[model samples]
Target: MRAVVIESPKQLHVTTLPDPTPGPGDVVVRVAGVGLCGTDVHMLAGEFGPTVYPVVPGHEFSGEIVAVGSEVQGYAEGDRVAADPAVYCGSCHFCAIGRGNLCEKWGTIGITMDGACAEYVKVPAANLYRLPQGVDLGHAPLIEPLSTIVHGLDVVAPSVGDHFLIYGAGTMGLLYLQTARRNGAASVSVVDLNADRLAVAEQLGADHVATSADELDRVTTGWEVVVDCTGAVPAIEDAFTRVRRGGTFQQFGCAPDQEQARFSPFRIYNDEIRIVGSMAILHSYGRALDLLAKGWIDSDTMITHRFGLDEYQKALDTFSQGTGRKIQIVPSLAPGA
Candidate 1:
């Protein structure tokens, strides 16, 4: 098997490696398509603190099962599936309280273990969610990221008819826009530095799009739900001020661990504003898959670039340049290969 290995910060190598074998409770998936998220970028740059080096860095992925563990049931070879990368210590205090996302020993597939930027990768059978009848593996990688966004919404728990103001029209931001509208936001507005992204947001059902929140009309007091998906310090700070009184503000993006943003504690208290942080996918992967199968999301338009596994570096480069929506790695399918 061949895979991409991050030797260290700024060091990457793609070469042949031994095929993975399923343990007693694991299954080995034949890699189909893998999506790269901002977390992968941070891992590659050594910015993600918990990432263990010499690890394969890909978490948002979709594939088919080729081998199942002896204890595995319900899933079999040839089953198209998307694996949830989140793995938590089941005995932690947070896990005991039904908050596995906050487990003390929280770890993810690509970040903490070898992942699917290869021809084959091992996954826990329990984490596998077989795709519904109509969903294809190509677009199914969106499930992982969408699930996280779903959890973000769960954190906000916004009521129907509430206005939503989202910062960042990147892949995650656009997904937030789609889901927010579906969740009954009266209107969804998007802000991004890129004009192209803002345009796509509008085409994807955003009521308004702009390079800055100040450019948006109406809702002058603020929005009922304000989400920051860019994770930039400035954007996070700006999003804080855009939340309407008694509204919720969700920090959904991954910012540098050392970075900090300013916000008004007085305003939060006086206006009854709620500030929450949504981590990665919780129990939302299955829901995300079901939503996609139900045609709730436009997956086709969400994924904009695909490359072969050998071109992992190229995928990273394109991602860094911020040229595409959801850039992915298809182990066997490179358009111009």
Candidate 2:
């Protein structure tokens, strides 16, 4: 099988390797589409912690099951599915409390283990969720990230009349806007440095879009929910201060580990502000699938580019340049290519 191999930090190769076989509790999926995000870039740069080099780095993927583990039930060949790449230690204290995302030994498929960047990848059967009959396998990759946002919403716990101010209008931010619109946000405002993304944000239902909060003068009373969807330190700091008194702020972006920002501790105490952090997918995977199946997300707008296995690096370039939205890798190239 030809796969994108991150042999080391700042190094990548598309090489042929032995195709994967299912473990007793796993299934082998013939890869269809895998979405590229900042996490994949960080993994390639060796910046994201727990990224083991010589690994395949695609976590957001959907495909068809070609082989099922002996112990697996209710799944078989020809089943279409999107997988939750998260793999957790079930005995950790966090897992005991239904917080597997916070498990002490938390790991993910593409990050810590081999992943679905190849023609065929093995996945745990427990992680597989069958795609609905009409859902595009190409767009199903969005479900993984959508699930993360769902968990973020769970953390912030938006109310019916809450106004949302989201920083970053990239794929994640626009998805946030759409979800907020559907979930009863009175208004959704977005901030981004990119005009392209901002325009898309408006198309996706962002009531107010700006390059910065200072440009959004009409939001004088502040927002009930302020979310930092951009992992940049400056954006995070600015968004954090925009939360209204008694409102909630969520850190939904994955910032560089060493980056730091200072928040006004006194304001948090005096104004009763709530700060919440969301990591990865939790129990929200199935809900995300439901939302996708229900046609809640505009798949056509979210995905902007597609590439075959040979064009993986080109896809990376397009993603890093911020010239496109979600870029996908279609790995099922001609056999032995």
Candidate 3:
């Protein structure tokens, strides 16, 4: 099997490795598509916390099952599937309470274990969701990220005709904008430092888009719901103050470990504001796939670039440049590549 291994920070190598055999309750998937996420970039830069070295870094992926574990019953060979990368200990307190996303012994694929940047990757059979007949393999990888946004929206519970202010115009922010509109938000505004991303937000149904925080005028203030997708400390801080009194502020981004932000404690109490931190997807994977299958989420327009397994460095460079929306890695190269 050929895999792209991150030997160290800022380094990647495409090397041959032994193919994985499915263990008990596991499935070996022939890698089809892998989406490059900010977490992958952070791992490459040694910014994300406590990642094992020489790991194949990719979790957002979809593929066909080539081998199934002896104990697996619901899945078999030739099943097209998308996987939930978050491996949780079923007996943990969080898992007991149905909050498996916060499982105590959570070990994510591609982060703590071998990921999908290879010819074949092994995953727990329990994590596999069979892709619908018409869903393209290329678009199946988007299920993970889309699920995250769905989970966030579930927590915020934005009402019809509610005003929304979304910070950042990246994939997550743009997806949230569309989801909010679908959920019946009458007016939505997206803010980002990148003009190009803001433009995409506009196309996705954001009523107003701005590049600077200062450009958020009085009319944009007092939004019923404000979402921070930038994961930057400054933006998170701004969100706390910008949301209307008694409104909801959703932090959907992951900031650096050492980053910190301060807010007015008195105002939080006085305004009766609700501050919610939405982490990874919680029971939203199936719903996300359903939406994708129904054409509610458009992966074609969101995915801007694609590269073969051999072009790992090129893919990383293009992603770092932030020239496009989403970059994808095709693990199996085409003929003559």
Candidate 4:
């Protein structure tokens, strides 16, 4: 089987590898589509802490099950599914307390193990969520990322009429916009440096879009819910100031490990503001899949580009350039296939 291997920091290649076979409790998925995001970018550059060299880097994906482990039950070959990439130790303190997202030994599929950026990849059977036969496989990859958005909302626990101001109009931001609308937000405002991304935010039900929060016409107190989806220091700093008194601020993006942002501690105390950080998927994958099946998200508009396994580098380049929404790699095809 052909796979993309990150041999070391600043090095990557699409090369052939032995086909993966399922373990007693795992299943082998014939890769259909895998989405690329900032985490993959960081992993490629050796910036993600959990990632090791000579690994395949792709986690947001979905495909058909070609082989099932001997112990797998209630699933069989030809079943279309998406697997949660999050791997955690069941005995960790966080996991014991139902916070597996912060498990002491937390790891993810692409970041910590060989992932679905190949013709076939192995996944724990318990992590697989079946997709409806009617759904398009190309768009199924969005479910994994969307699940993170779901978890973010769960962390915020915002009121139905709360106004939202989200930083970044990238894929995660756009998903946040759509989900906020569905969650009964009084208004959803999106901010991004990219005008094209703002336009897409508008198309996806954002009540307002702008390059900066200063350009938005909101109350002097600011939005009831503020979210940072850029993982950018500047964006996170700006987003922190947009939360209204007694409102909530969510760090939903994967910021660089070494960066820091400034916030008014006095204001947080006086205004009763709550600041929370949402990690990766946490028991939300199934809910996200159900939402996708219910048409809560516009998957068609969310995905903007496609590449094959052989074009993984090109896909990563486009991602680094910040040129598209959800870019995907279909491991079974060539560049334009």
Candidate 1 achieves a global lDDT of 0.90
lDDT leaderboard ranking: 4, 1, 2, 3
For lDDT, candidate 2 versus 4, the one ahead is 4
Report the Cα lDDT for residue 179, model 1.
89
Error of 2 at 315 (Å): 1.3
TM-score for each candidate, following the candidate numbering: 0.97, 0.96, 0.94, 0.97
195-245 per-residue lDDT for model 2 (tens digits):
989999988888999988988954577899999988889999989889999
Off by over 4 Å in 1: none
Off by over 4 Å in 4: none
Which is superior by TM-score, 3 or 4? 4
Q: Give the TM-score of candidate 1.
A: 0.97
Off by over 4 Å in 2: 333-337
Distance from true location, Cα of 233 in model 1, Å: 0.8
lDDT of 2 at 295: 87
Structure candidate 1, residue pairs in collision: none
Per-residue lDDT of model 3, residues 8-110, tens digit only:
8877788999999999989999999898887888788877775678799899999999999999998989999999888888899999999988888877888
lDDT of 1 at 181: 86
lDDT of each: 0.90, 0.89, 0.86, 0.90
Model 2 CA lDDT for position 232:
89
